[model samples]
Target: MTASRSSTRSPSVKVAEVSPSAASCLNVLILPLAIFNWYGGTWIRNELEVVVVVVVVVVVVVVVVVVVVVIIIVVMMIITIIIKNHNYAFIINRVPLYSA
Candidate 1:
């Protein structure tokens, strides 16, 4: 027995309608003047000043936390060394050791 094959066709393009009463498409002559005069330079300066303040606050907080952690670690190490060094000789020798 033999089988049959089928073929498909592509779709066509579409067209849009334009009106005569519409204004010209390139009518943006006053856009730059409007934008520059709208907010001026103070807006950008204020934004940058706020960003710098926020960054400085973040850095200060991180440095303080790091210093606190380092101090805690140093205190713990000093305590450990003192305990090890000042222990009685007999007490240390009395501890048992495991061997294989």
Candidate 2:
């Protein structure tokens, strides 16, 4: 079996490989989108928007999951009681006749 060799280049050498003009062009390509020109705003506004959206989505998901779990538990309890008792009439008669 033959092993393949990987050459690791130093960070300085890698940065030098990309010409200044090329680097500046790359910056131009990236900067406009990264600068948050969606509505022409500052970095803080963009970060805040991202944080708010994430928090809202997380809260909504948590509420939905909790509601679903509670509903499932209630349904299971009702089913278990019905199966254990085996007599619907017994429960109805008991509830009205007994105070405790």
Candidate 3:
């Protein structure tokens, strides 16, 4: 009876010891994965932010260039019209008018 009781108790004690070691092993395996996930997510977010800023800057530069070009073209057209009108008036004054 004594030997049987000891055998049963020994198995239970062994099981109790093995349970803690198994739990520790699981922790060891899972901790690195959790850390990697946190850092990896942050890295990806930083990269996305940089891309957004670059795209916005490029868009702004393009819009400014287009606006400047349009203004220059409009100014040139106005100057051309003024010069032509002045020349026409000078030519009319130089011509002689005869009364019939």
Candidate with top TM-score is 1
Q: Model 3 — which ten-residue stretch has the worst lDDT? A: 9-18
Clashing pairs for model 3 are none
Q: Residue by residue across 42-83, what tens digits does model 1's lDDT show?
A: 343554554465567668989999999999999999999998
TM-score of each: 0.44, 0.41, 0.43
Enumerate clash totals for all models, in the order shown.
Answer: 0, 0, 0
Cα lDDT of candidate 2 equals: 0.69
Q: Candidate 3: TM-score?
A: 0.43
Candidate order (TM-score):
1, 3, 2
Which is superior by TM-score, 1 or 2? Answer: 1
Candidate 2 versus truth, CA RMSD in Å, comes to 15.9
In Å, residue 13's CA in model 1 sits off its true spot by: 36
Q: What is the lDDT of candidate 3?
A: 0.69
Residue lDDT tens for model 2, 1-100 = 1233246554566443878997687566545456665657655456456556556766998999999999999999999998877967777776776565
Looking at model 1, report the run of 10 residues with the lowest lDDT sum: 21-30
Which segments of candidate 3 are over 4 A away from where they belong?
A: 1-45, 88-100
Query: What is the Å distance of residue 66 in model 1 from its true position?
Result: 0.2
